[model samples]
Target: MYKNKYEPALDIYRRTLDNQLKLIHGDHRDIAASLSGISWALGYIGHTEEALEYSMQSLAIQQRCTPSYHPMLAHTLRAI
Candidate 1:
């Protein structure tokens, strides 16, 4: 749904991302979710390398802050 409605959905997602990033700009682990959003959007836009890079970055951050078996960590791992 979102992938097909990029123009409209993107603003909403971008706003959400801005808010979250504002709260945890330098906290890589805390901003894993936002990073995931970026990766998702990049993937939807066909930027495979950028998407994978962001996914890996998010995965690394989550691994550092959460347990290895955490749900978000799992998602990030699979995404990469």
Candidate 2:
């Protein structure tokens, strides 16, 4: 939803993301992916503090779920 109109999409995205996250178990990859998407949308809309926070969360999850040298870890780090 970050494609067409950024701010509005983020508002919509935020409203649903948390509830979805609650249904996810542990530190799943899908949780990290959702966090990354939210972070990207927040960053794109100039909410840098929130963006950074979510990105950091994503990074932490990726770190725990993947190997140190994993490609996804590198990607999540770059995202932050």
Candidate 1 has what TM-score? 0.73
- Backbone Cα, N, C clashes tallied per candidate: 0, 0
Clashing pairs in 2: none
Residues 1-80, model 2: lDDT tens digits: 33568777666667656866778768877777778888878888788999999889889988889889988778878877
The top-ranked prediction according to lDDT is 2
TM-score of every candidate relative to the true structure: 0.73, 0.77
Q: What's the C-alpha lDDT at position 30 in model 2?
A: 71
Candidate 2, 73: how far from true, in Å?
A: 1.6
Per-residue lDDT over 1-80 for candidate 1, one digit per residue giving the tens place of the 0 to 100 score = 43476445446666776787777656566578867877877788788898898788788788778887799888887787
**Could you tell me how far off, in angstroms, the CA of residue 38 lies in candidate 1 after the best superposition?**
0.8
**lDDT of every predicted structure (CA atoms):** 0.75, 0.80
